[model samples]
Target: MSILNSSALRPSSLILIGIPGLESYHIWFAAPLSIIYIATVLGNVMLLLAITTVLKLQKPMYIFISQLAFSDLVLSTCAVPKMLDIFWYNSREIQLSACITQMFFIHLMLVFESSILTAMSFDRYVAVCNPLRYHSILTHALIAKLSALSLLRAIVVIVPLPLLTLRLSFCSRCIAHSFCTNMAMTKISCADITVNNVYAMFVSLFLGPVDIICIALSYSLIVRLVLRLPHKDARLKTFSTCSSHISVMSALYVPFFFGTLLTLFPNRIPVHVHILVANTYLIVPPLINPLIYGLTVKEVRQSMYLLLQNCKNRIRLWASSRVWR
Candidate 1:
């Protein structure tokens, strides 16, 4: 029996099934996945560029938006390329160390994104609730400190996850999802993963609820403050300023919460549905976040338009010079 058990153990290299039950459609899936990944990268990069070059956008809110864009870029880049590889090239063999590293970055980015969103909410709260003191409260120094703290918090929270995973003995080396996630890897371990499960639950319960409550409270205060504003236009403008943030937050968290629930209750949901939701949870925010900001925020839109016009003018000048030559 011991010999049989030893023979049954998988190799150190793990095979990632891009979408377990949908293997036949992996080729079809890769196209859209690639498109989303490309769009995400381009959109976020454009947002970052706009923020960096545009003087008018050098405010606290845009700074936080740029940070969020950076986080989305990092998060999507960490997962989507590997996912595309699995789907397009059938290159699914990921080493244990590599998988652990991937899991670490993915979770780190997730937490960092959450922290940034929380910070953005606080920024909004200060801007609307105490407009007179907004600049005093959210100074450039404070923004830098908050950004640094967000990264540090993410590192502190996510560093142990891979370590805990490393302690386990993985009997099965096949990950059902496209990416190597902590939960997915934990489920494959032959050891008693009760501790890992508990830790994951602890993190989720602590982080998710705290972020949600803080955001909800911030918005609640904003709403109340807006209601008390005597001018309807003032209230409308304040609420409008918040709508983009709300849309981005919803895009980031809703699918994530739903995906977490699906993971917890995997038996109720179909495997394909779970996988799709998980992918969406990972992919959708980065893809849509820049679009939300670009379309909703006037400064960003104006900056993007200016940048495009410059590019067009440069191209036309080059063509004209070539004709003269």
Candidate 2:
């Protein structure tokens, strides 16, 4: 009898095989992963705080950046802690409901981040190509609406994924990857997964490519406009403004593109390599996004410097008082 056809009790929990073939080194892997996770959280939090509290950063671009920071925070928090649990404690058991929940949020944040990047690209396009109307066009109200719609689109598309997973009877409960994903879950399903596969394909084709195309187009036009500027310094200044966003876009899309390719051509790649790329896809962007923004954007850099100075002064004052006492 086929494993799919055999009548077995529906599993309540699934075992995640974290980094297959690397079980012996899970503890060692946890060390660097823990540091990256902590840095992602702290850096994103600091960026969020700086964007929110600083009066000078209340502009539309900063507002979009804050959204990006928030999304990164949520994305990292959703996956990393569970990954660490598997690494450090060997706690591989995850409930079916919990797995579905994790899958939903993971995809949700991925789509949200993509949409936000597209929106940010548009923000840049307008600012560069139509400087006179940039403020009028990308007002706070419009930025809020764009952010809301990005989130809404993600929720609407991703909500059905977990429900679809629920309809399938799994022949196996062992997830080869560290995290639950649509493909990972569906791979174990006993039933016909045509609908699930179609939806996944639709999301991959529609969301990823559409957003990438929009971003590319936006930058292309921005570049054309910048080149036409009469003053060299003005053109340089305008181009500099886009450098940070371009860096961020590269950081995100390059790994993601390769990771997707590895997933699609799993036969060509080793399992451990696939797992490493998969983890890097989620970890690298969040880890570097804040640092890229802080170092590249002048306003954010200045604000962070000011914040550190204040912290230094407070620490010095406290130490001096303690010595006097």
Candidate 3:
């Protein structure tokens, strides 16, 4: 869309084409996507409550799990409603400023999610590798620092996207994707985008690759230690302890890199495929993360079950206490 006249002024807003090549099916697509969004919200919120309300789940490990749930909640919530608006309501016009804000939060949550996963891996490593001092090392002060640092790192890294975006002038105020990303915005800019391109590469590498490396390193050490255990039962238990996290990490990073690759090879990959990958990357993690943790981790399942039973009993009590007469 950069085919506009060099003198054309930047428009105040951009029009998004919700899922290119599938405009005819936009409304049809809305049903399942809306259901997914609703389910994601409920799942993450349930997991978040389970972690926070359960006394046994107040440990540092579960603290990280809660952060993951919260991150997924914000991540999906940040983008899905707007996307549904575009699809269901045909509300395509997004103010340039608001679009930039959306871009900021979406990426912020993604980066923060990566940091939280890395923190989780570190927690597991410490728990398995240094069992006795797990509590002492992962103190409240340290957990608070790690949590603060996760948000601070996310902000410091992602905040520059909007600042950098301000310097560019758009050739066309039309975005062809479901949401605003650095690449989507840069694609339509009239200005020389070498700096933007370089910075985007830097941000992608910084946010994703660095976090992947840290997670990998942590898990490798944990696995190595687990391998040296004398008893097969202990080894099985340690692997079981790690399976849920590994599943979560795969759910996060695999599609992320796949989407990035699709974005990079835009000509080779179909546009709709790239968009689907991007949208699913944001949505699936929130939906499946709770399932992964809730089902795999016995304590979380028990907590959620208890919470449900308590709610059920309260309803019965409230119904019985009512003055029918």
Candidate 4:
């Protein structure tokens, strides 16, 4: 019987590699992954709150930063907790329904993240290219509109993905990744995955390249405008404002695009290279985004400082009131 046809056997039966057995692998894998998960969740939350609660961070650029952080928050939440379970609890077994839900959220967040980058680039373009019109261009109403458009873009593009995936018949239910990633899941399917694979290709070509191109074009325009300014300090500061973003964008996109290509052309790469590139592509961007923003963006750093002070003051006030009581 084909792996997919034997539905009676657990899907995890097909996917797991060496590690003695299910019980041992769970304990070993779960412990270290837990640390990564905690930091991932905590760091992103702190970044989000720092952006939201600080009055000085209410500008358009920071608003986009907050939106990006929020999307990463949602993305990490969907993937990491389940990953922790598989590692710690010997619970690699997943219901078909849960797998579908996981896939949907994963792609949704992916689409939203790319959309946010595109929007942020546009925000920079307007700020640097047309400074006088920036406030007028990026008003509260416009921010709301952009957010709505971003969400719509994700839903419209990725909604078809799940529907297409549902049509695939599983040949072997085992998924290789720690969690039910799309390519891993598709690999186990018995049915022809041509349509689903084609759709994945469409995402890479249309949504993926389009976002990267848009960001590059926006920055190119910004650079051209910055060069026209007479003040040396202004030109340098403008480039500095965008340098972190450009760096993070490269970090996120370069590996991501290569990983997508590697997945599509598995024959072109060695197994170890494929695995290393794919994992790095997935993990590094999520981890580094908050760090880049925190270090490079003055507003985020100041807000974090103020938030820490506020927390200390609150604790001291509570202690004093308790002593009086």
lDDT digits (tens) for residues 243-322 of candidate 2: 98998888888887888887778788888888888788799999999999999998998887887788799999999999
Report lDDT (CA) for all predictions. 0.89, 0.89, 0.89, 0.75
Query: lDDT value for candidate 3?
Result: 0.89
Off by over 4 Å in 2: 1-8, 315-325
TM-score of 1: 0.94
On TM-score, the leading prediction is: 3
lDDT of 4 by residue, 1-325 (tens): 1335553333434443212224354566567657765766666777888978877788888888788777777777776677666656655566777777777887887788888888889988888888899999999889988888999999998888778777777766656565556677678777778888888778878888889889989988988888998999999999997887787788778898887778766777665466556556555677778888888887788787777788899999999999999
lDDT of 2: 0.89
Better of 1 and 3 by TM-score: 3
Per-residue lDDT value at 108 in model 4: 88
Q: For candidate 1, write residues 150-186 as lDDT tens digits.
A: 9999999999898898888866667888998888888
lDDT of 4 at 27: 67
RMSD of each: 2.9, 2.8, 2.2, 3.6
**lDDT of predicted model 1:** 0.89
TM-scores of the models, in the given order? 0.94, 0.93, 0.94, 0.87
Point out the higher-scoring one by lDDT: 3 or 4: 3
- Superior by TM-score: candidate 1 or candidate 4: 1
